[model samples]
Target chain A: MSLDAPTDHTGLRVMGAEECLERLASVPVGRIAFTGNGKVAILPVHHVVKGVDVCFRTSGGSKIEAAADHASVGFEVDSYDPSTRSGWSVTVSGIATVVDDDGLVVELEASDPTPWTMGDRSREVWIRIRTDELSGRELTRT
Target chain B: MSLDAPTDHTGLRVMGAEECLERLASVPVGRIAFTGNGKVAILPVHHVVKGVDVCFRTSGGSKIEAAADHASVGFEVDSYDPSTRSGWSVTVSGIATVVDDDGLVVELEASDPTPWTMGDRSREVWIRIRTDELSGRELTRT
Candidate 1:
């Protein structure tokens, strides 16, 4: 917290893992970062938090391919209010793997994860991110 | 384009680099994805479009270290409106390097890049991402 800003002007708080996970669950969309084609990539997707896993559906594409390759990934969800100059961001670092367990896939489908994008995504492949570490921070104008 | 949704229900468009750069300029914040400690990391930063480069200021931490190590990075900015289920995202893949030129650093300071977080970041290091490739996609409900 070596911030140069006046202490009275703002506050910075490090949130606990449980609180971070809770914030993640409250958001429907987040960006997933992974390595693909020798480059790091960040793409937005709709995700569902189930137990300790974060799952998202991706049509067989670069993202899915990267997941199948077992890329280390980061998933982030955040919200900011411009007028208030305040926001919180949560990031989960983990290994992303394609979901192939038929029963678990069925369970996820039954849970009704929304793609929220135009496309025939109903039959898209599922990828689950097994969380390894979670960290979050909040910035607020005091 | 392997969408399962009806073609009439949505429209997808690929934007040229110029258009993508335009969208990038309009946004103030984006997520930078890079490899850190053999794991993918994504962190949000306030950035400004500078010529053909994207510039941001980061406190000397993991991100700066990653840049110093010359890791390939992905910088992404996007806007999504839930009401319409539509948005466009632009991703820039490039090598991130620390800005060592004092004159350029002073110019950036005049440009006023916002860190939007807490800390004594005014004298923090500056990182410039030299874009090697730029791509963007738009999803709209027709």
Candidate 2:
């Protein structure tokens, strides 16, 4: 180990499932990773948590293409503090699809998941990830 | 189209190749993503931009598994300020491999890319992504 290692002791801890979901709900932004055009690509997106599912807005791109394929995707949210040498990251692996159901769309509408860079909101497509696995890791002071 | 969108005018800017590498080197941390077991996974890692390759250390995990398979990997780094509605993200997609060359290791040693959560640095594996594609986007105030 390099001498530059942090002076205080730290350890990696595995977070419980419920805690992972709670943390996921705490962030409004995260990244979505999907395979499109034979490459695994990732996009940072504005997101909201809805009953164990992740909802995000996109204005039709690789993400929408992947969702059309019913692709398996990974969504991640993290907070890191280099000064304290502590942080937590949560990862959700799930199937991604477009949201077309009116009832669920109305529910999600209240959360107001926003698109980051699109010119038009009316043209946005709502993508939902039906989470199959939820896990997280935290780096904590020992 | 977001009411919450930064009230000040903002636009998405595409970054050129050289500026992307400069920004990549400016930060010591980034996330490496790869396809493993039919799912894309991501890990936050300490990285060094070597010429055009991104080198990070890990004690062997899904990243190693994918590298061993000569898998295409995605490395992403970004910074965003919700208040400014501005930030930038740089992503490198490339084929990943383990670095075992003594000469290159000694050269890479000078930069010292450390593993974040691994216990023993001595057992750390250095994975390099020989970048085939490099692109970046910045959310900028217009």
Candidate 3:
């Protein structure tokens, strides 16, 4: 699609669920959204995909405390190339929970992903989001 | 500070508030976070600054509707240079509200920013965050 095409302010193409998941998995960084203190907080996280869940490590504290039992959360991954003025984004909506299974923790640690925050392991926590409600958008260069 | 120096994981050397605001003003894109249907939803917004309040034009649908009634929101802007493995990020935390003030809108529109999304202005929402709560971090190149 050409970036100079007539703009369609009312038109938004909805992407399929499966496609959104695939694209989201390809990206390494995304923002995690959750409610805290009656307001919305977004934090950047480095994530890895396992099966249909998105998982990331956090160093304890408020983020996990607020989201552990949270019924739903949002995870989004996007990439933009300013030179081309084009990018795509994928958003996944699902419940969040603390991943405590020993086996899963080992696997997650084996991945050795860099944490977004510089902290000791005192706040080690992992959150996974279900993949049922996933959607995406691709912005063409214009 | 040299990149080789060990730094606290969460220890981000603070920049002056005005410096933070100046950096934010130069950036055209940022991520807006809110609670949508009890889940976390984050969308990229093309925003402008009015003093300390961050304002952006949206479609007046999901982003606006979900953020109504003093929603706690986070607006984040960052720039990364992969070759040097260096970057800086600034986050603003505050409530989001729909603004109807014509004079402020006209001043904002006069800036003539190029919209990141292909859409007309169905809604113009302003999110105001406290300047004191704003923080930033810059990574030193090795």
Candidate 4:
């Protein structure tokens, strides 16, 4: 991995696919984009890595309802270091579908997501997206 | 605006139209989503408020190029306070178009952006999205 310092106000580096995915795996927070009422809604989610696909649990409300039709969606994960004035961001674009298998739910229940928000798991819905078409950019303070 | 804490993990707090637009206006940084090569590309942008529309600068590259066809786009601005575990997010979905009017450029140049990223003014392109359709959600930690 290239760890160059950022300079001036214009030091941006492109991150390779593998490096981006690795960084994403380490972080659990990201924004998920989907269509809603002829517009787009971006929501923050706590996600996990299942192979190359990114999975996250959500309640069956607007997000699940809007994405029920398997609409095209985008998932983005990014981390910024303010002290160094550097950061990296990764975006994944794919179709989203609801996962409703009892066996899969059992497996996901065993895994713990580093939750930053407090809430009840009333609506347990899962969203998975393919990671083949992933691209990212990293900015360093040099 | 309802300030009650959300019991569910889903960050769903409805706000008035004016309040929603005000949140989007106050924030200088946001992500812009567009369709590219049959896939969605979400790019972070520094935006300024122009009347009811949101405006931002971009180069004649990936972002501007992909959004040239006036495709359906989504723009989002949000803030999360981990300390209080309270935050809100606003999303705008509309058609995007490239504006090259010098008058508008002069108007935008006079205004200052929050400068959250590092990039030079190599290219000067402006993007505007109508604010007729806007929605938002606020979440308070329980």
> What tens digits encode model 4's per-residue C-alpha lDDT throughout B7-97?
2345556777788889988766778877666556677777888877888877556455457556678888877765565677788877787
Residue-by-residue lDDT tens digits, candidate 3, B1-142: 5445334455445566777798888777778877756567777766888888788777656555456556677778877654454567777888777666777667767774566666656554544443336766665433
Q: By DockQ thresholds, what CAPRI class is model 2? A: acceptable
Clashes of 1: 9
- Looking at model 2, residue B97 earns an lDDT score of 88
Best-performing candidate as measured by TM-score: 1
Instruction: Report the lDDT tens digits of candidate 1 across residue range A5-107.
Output: 3232124577777888899998778899888778888888878898877998777664554555677899888888766767888999988888989999989
- Pitting candidate 1 against candidate 4, the one with the higher DockQ is 1
Give the Å error, residue B89, model 2. Answer: 0.6
Per-prediction RMSD in angstroms?
A: 4.6, 5.7, 3.9, 4.0
Q: Candidate 2: what's its TM-score on chain B?
A: 0.84
Q: Which portions of model 3 show Cα errors greater than 4 Å?
A: A1-9, A113-117, B1-11, B81-86, B121-132, B139-142
Q: What TM-score does chain A of model 4 get?
A: 0.80
- Maximum-DockQ candidate: 3
Candidate 1 structure quality by residue, lDDT tens digits, B80-141: 88777677889898989988999999899889745576656654778899899998888876
Residue B109 alpha-carbon offset, candidate 3, angstroms: 1.2
lDDT of each: 0.79, 0.75, 0.69, 0.69
Q: lDDT: which is higher, 2 or 4?
A: 2
RMSD of 4: 4.0
